[model samples]
Target chain A: MKRIMILVLAITTGLGVLAYTTHSAPQADDVKVISITAKKFDFTPGEITVKKGVPVALELTSSDRVHGFSFPDFKLTAKIEPGKVTRVVFTPDKTGEFTFSCNIFCGSGHEEMAGRLIVTD
Target chain B: MKKLVLAITVLLVIALMIGVGVFKLGLVPVNADVPPSGLETRFIPIAVHASVANHAEEQPNPMVPTDENLIAGGEVYTVMCARCHGVPGRGPSVLGASFYPPAPQFTVQPSGYSEGELFWIVKHGIRNTGMPAWGRLLSDQDIWHVVAVLRRLNSLPSAVENSRSKLH
Candidate 1:
């Protein structure tokens, strides 16, 4: 009876350690940071490529006016303010080229504001 | 005594959880209607004017509006602003309708602003909101034209007067 109680305690402690490690493990990969600037209804370097499951940090800013950087598929939107840098972090879950657009109306050319995000396995 | 304390603690935890759940599942009606008023109609424009005045001090004046310049402004607005602000006669377009805070019907809500104030808002743009500044891509004259067109929107023969009554 004494041995059985000790064995049960040991098993519970082992399970606790396993659960803690698994729950606390970092789920994202270290990824390269990309910078994009929106100005006059256009994104500078309007296309970029990355690997699937890799975290991507987007450092965005507006050169002139306020603009919205939105990736609908990723459920992400970052408001880029003039003269201030905003960062958006996400791990690409799928492999494909996704489109990002400026939702803000900058002027007559606002509709032309668009960019591409490419992800590969 | 320990058992009694644990029982009281459990009751307290359950009561707290119920309170939070009730708050999260709000009891307010989703469609509670409220009548529109002059105060409601003027709120955005007033806010916009205040913001423009504040931003104007920080940003440079790159555009100057004039009668001759409005023709250029008209062309730009036709391509861009027409879709949302509408083409003087037609109502705010489909895109404007879908916005969370629907784009103000600029026709009825003509910016009660000086030409310089309009230019500053168009150049610096509003933050977080859907407005974008055109200062970088557009030449000084381009921005002036846009502002000029906005000033003319209220006077356009096609523009309907007192249309604010129709808007929710």
Candidate 2:
């Protein structure tokens, strides 16, 4: 009977902590949304600034050809197809500057496609 | 255990010998005159992709595309880039053929590089090619001006045409 009581207390304590943690964190839907346009070899409004801990919804639009958008530091990659909108929701946990680039091959100057994301504490 | 170690050692030495032989014998094509092998052609794109993706600048071309800016860009292009890239109404340049991977003709091939992309290329230039880094020679504003001119490489605006000198 004592063992059973101890096991039940432990389980209840674990459940309480899990519930608190889940409720404290922000959800993807709660983050702010920003639209970015990707063209032959550049992204408009190249520098983006966001607050740490808050999630952001990035809507990517390709103006001309199919381009790739990748935040290598964050291990995030998204494809931006012409005439289509690609939505990516991410929460930056750390505070620093991150570079995002196009991993796909477009043309001769394809390599010069990169942008920066600045996160503040 | 001793026999196993001996066998492994023999195999390792054999592999090293083969590697050395390939290098000393000149079995691999090292000359730029030779067209790139199939494997090299396949690999070069991946290497260039990784390099450009890593180094490209994020900022858009800061200089506004004014008429003066375009003319300056045209003059710079005719001076710095035309020796290899060729100029308008002048047939292919003899120097263009000298390069292993021939210098691209802007009149024939229009690279869809962005303004910033063009600026970066003109400033830093490409490696393993005839292109040389102009960043040390040109200022940032001048590079942007060059990019403005490249935008209309094939279809030169009248103003850009007026900017070109007879020497080009």
Candidate 3:
């Protein structure tokens, strides 16, 4: 009886902790999906705007080689492999213009491979 | 003996479950701004050093640290690396400092990595770190040139220093 009671207590505490933890990935219907393509030295749609507080899913793909997306302000980074889509989801809590750039060295023009993210209140 | 084995197995199973729960429940901090914990500070360097030693080829730098070669490396460094690693005369970059494992200010504190290790790291970036692989973008010769510059960052040739100063 003591062993059973201990097990029951452990399960209850585990469930409570899991429920309390914040989960960021929102359901499909709740997120606003945006498709962005990366090539040699540019992220198509060089500028993107999203409403603050709304979960935004950026579906990134590369047409040339492996590229990377780093939104430093959001602390989000992902590799966009050629012939594959990498989905990065996050909610913009603050409203501002943030620069997103390709952290991966692509070519001579790699330094210029950057875009802007405009988060609206 | 059988009872001891059974007790150990049960403990292992419980530990595995807890580990999985922590990750699946997003309990692990993923933020980049937070400083690394003591555990990471102690173990990560050991792991990186071991990995570099194991994977990086045991070889010497092919390019001689000639003034021209050093200058060439400086050009690449000024364009590609200075933004994060920092330039000799300038301060640490704000963008570089914001990284989870902050990008080392190599100019301020010269990297202890050997030429070969630097070559391997520049060719293939460290995973989960902000450093990016330049293999696809830079030729082998270019990489060697960069390595040459990195080795002599504290004592760059006058010509290279002059060229670096031209960059803002």
TM-score of 3: 0.59
- DockQ for model 2? 0.01
Model 2 steric clash pairs: none
Deviation in Å, model 1, residue B42 alpha carbon: 7.5
Where's the lowest-lDDT run of ten residues in candidate 3 chain B?
B133-142
- Which scores greater on TM-score, model 1 or model 2? 2
Across residues A5-54, which tens digit of lDDT does each residue of candidate 2 receive? 99999999999999999888766567888899999778887999999988
lDDT string for model 3 (A18-91, tens) is 87676645567899899999998999989999999999999999999988787869988888998999999999
Off by over 4 Å in 3: A1-121
Candidate 2: residue B103 lDDT (0-100): 74
- Clash pairs of candidate 3? none
Candidate 2: stretches off by over 4 Å: A1-121, B1-16, B25-27
Candidate 1 chain B lDDT trough over 10 residues, lowest sum? B159-168
How far in Å is the alpha carbon of B65 misplaced in model 3? Answer: 2.1
Docking class of 2: incorrect
Judging by DockQ, tell me the better candidate of 2 and 3: 3
The TM-scores that each candidate's chain B achieves against the reference are 0.57, 0.79, 0.93
- DockQ category of candidate 3: incorrect
Model 1: how far residue B15 lies from native, Å: 17
Best by the TM-score measure: 3
- Sorting all predicted structures by lDDT, with the top scorer first, yields 3, 2, 1
How would you encode candidate 1's per-residue C-alpha lDDT over B1-168 as one tens digit per residue?
A: 999999999999999999888878995333313333467456966786687877675443344444445555666667656667665667666676554345556865786667787788777777644667655435456677677668767573222223321222
